[model samples]
Target chain A: MAVDEVKLLGFWGSPFALRVEWALRLKGIEYEYVEEDLSNKSLMLLQYNPWYKKVPVLVHNGKPIVESLVIIEYIDETWKNHPLLPEDPFERATSRFWAKFVDDKFVPLIIKMSSSTREQKDKVAEEAREILKTLESCLNLNKPFYGGKIIGFMDIAVAWIGIWAPMLEKIIDVKLLNEEYMPLLNTWFSDVLEVLVIKECVPPLDELLAHYKDYYDRFMATKA
Target chain B: MAVDEVKLLGFWGSPFALRVEWALRLKGIEYEYVEEDLSNKSLMLLQYNPWYKKVPVLVHNGKPIVESLVIIEYIDETWKNHPLLPEDPFERATSRFWAKFVDDKFVPLIIKMSSSTREQKDKVAEEAREILKTLESCLNLNKPFYGGKIIGFMDIAVAWIGIWAPMLEKIIDVKLLNEEYMPLLNTWFSDVLEVLVIKECVPPLDELLAHYKDYYDRFMATKA
Candidate 1:
């Protein structure tokens, strides 16, 4: 049976949710957006995602798909318009590589930074530097986005990292995206922000900052 | 230019390397296999995989694709003969979810079992149980493989993990995949092993155990 109704369950503050929303919008697919409060998730959200119970679950014709990357791929394949991946086999694989790389490296780096002691944070900082170096090399190829000409799968998959990188610097007091350390990454970030779709999809900077501040305050209070 | 040559550079003991071999065989794509000695990797392997400089790098018509999951996708797209992924978008995403899950969870479990201190072994064991439990629950869909009937991408992506799981239990003097703990997983293991491509590509158990023992010995010595 061909699925007609597409729905998204997401938290407004979540970059993962934003990525799915952007992909759906770009594909010209109309989807009902159900905002999820992460602190107190809806019964529907829990039912849809019993395992992870994470937001950014896409329900298409009543079938729920979880994991932001996997959801994005589902959206792309299901909707033919505004292709998210390249038609070329090698190019698609390249994009998937970067997507997996960001998921594997960047998210964990941020988590480590958030939870680790002062000494461990230093080691994580070094690890983050190495990951950024790899991205810088990929950028050196002169590709405007990770997809070469347009924002493709890799860009969306790592979109959360791009959004969080600047905010993390504020909390950790480490200038990570500066031109001095990561010139290419800085350029890439600027290019990504200039995209109309990405700009629209991203939550306002003020709201994101407020959310982070609240979390940091709570985390520190617990530690005390 | 439609370049038809497919070459896989691999180390014998690596499950990642075996994934490509099984995928290629499943697709019935005849290709050249170059076994790389991990201690002394060939220049071609290094040139092909400068990023991680790791084994199981697939060079298709001179372009290198590192990472096993990425390589499997490339193989599927390149060869149109036998499809590793299902035609349905949701089903495809489901397969990929399990693949990513196994990739994220199984790799750490194997590494921990192979080299973690005795004090840390129990913690790792507990973590493995949790992940395997998730897998078992997902397996309730009544599928022989991760997909309904035929072995799909998730099966091939995780085929290597099942091979390593038994071996790791031997190393730790524990039964990780016992029928008592996970009867579904035990049945799934039997089903996955029944596939001809997986059956043929798996190296002899003694060979893999010998290789792992040597690697573990050296790893422990370095830690000492």
Candidate 2:
């Protein structure tokens, strides 16, 4: 049998790229990671993901898979040892539903917050809080993670909220995941951050904060 | 074992609902279809899917699954007779990628065209055509369907385009999925419409067209 050749093309600051990284690490898969310069992307990145031409492209045995969530699903299917999605079909469907919700609804609001202007910031934060509240309702304080007991697919899908939401809150001076409003989500965040695999893959807090701050400043400067 | 109980909550005009109906029919699964009144939704619809409170919701043996694509997946996984998604892991990933593309990118533009102002109609049509062109490039003339010979997941996800795009074109006095610009996609649309199960599930053309025309008139009246 041929050796499994796995490669991930990613950008350091992107939460989406980090998702693929966390999934790989949680599965204890060995692979090469290539950091792409977003300003001037590598030809390989372009060739691998022509549709999006974006990061978190996974190459396995010379076949390229794009879309972060799709890549994660492929990984879970290929590797049986550490199952990311649930065994039962209905549970798997529920997992995919929330994961899509996070991607389609939650993440976009967070991204909107990052680029929002002085006038737009408060409105965006208010909207983010509303979404956070919806997410809060779904989580159980008794369950340590979205996967109930283990750090599973939903954990990886949503881990960025714990890391990036705080960074945005600090930069914009608005609260999103307030303990008063979203206690379960706040606890979930704290617990997810403590997972060793997740912690190992997260960019250092200080570095991530600085990066976000710089990004916000540059974006605001252009607007001004 | 007890007999399996399956139910689908759907709205007749919805392409998303039709996708679920097509999947169940293709798999030869017996299901009770409940038509949802979007204006005043049923209690069961609300209870089953409080998150969106929208169709199509698939209930199998007392468990409800929301999101059209996710529901289709659940159906495919539970019933083993006919496989909607390919067996190869990479092919499955590719199928998912295109399905997401159709949902995320393509569907929105078509929906936009529906409510677009007289002024916004041309630009939205232009944008829809641009997306259609990209979809065109991915399709091969040699293959009869998005899944090559068989109508599969991608086919179901995109079936709405063949049905709704032309309706929008007729209503708006603009053309999308034009034969000259997107030959393969146009051909693919023609071939998919001929499929037996798909033919069975599609809403009657006259009724669907009248519904869309009425919808467009009401929307325009509100704007005016």
| lDDT by residue for model 2 (B1-224), tens | 88899999999999999999999999998999999999999999999998788899998989999999899889889998789998888989988998898888877877787777777888888988988887777776788777778889988988788999888889888888788888888888888988988998899989999998998889889988
Residues B1-224, model 1: lDDT tens digits: 76478889998888888888989998888889999988887899888887688989998788999999889988999888778988899889988888887877667776777677786787788788778877888774655777567787877777665788788877676556768878887788888987877787789999889888777788889989
Highest TM-score, which number?
2
Candidate 2 lDDT over A82-194, as tens digits, reads 89998889989988998898888877777787777767878888977887788777786778887879988888888788998888889888888789878888888988988
lDDT of 2 at B116: 76
Full-model lDDT for every candidate: 0.82, 0.88
In angstroms, the error of model 2 at A192 is 1.8
Worst 10 residues of 1 chain B by lDDT: B139-148
List the lowest-lDDT window of 10 residues for candidate 1 chain A.
Answer: A172-181
Candidate 1 lDDT tens digits, A116-198 = 77787778878887887787777646668876687878777776667788888888665456678777787787888778977
Q: Supply candidate 2's per-residue lDDT for B1.
A: 89
TM match of model 1 to true structure? 0.89
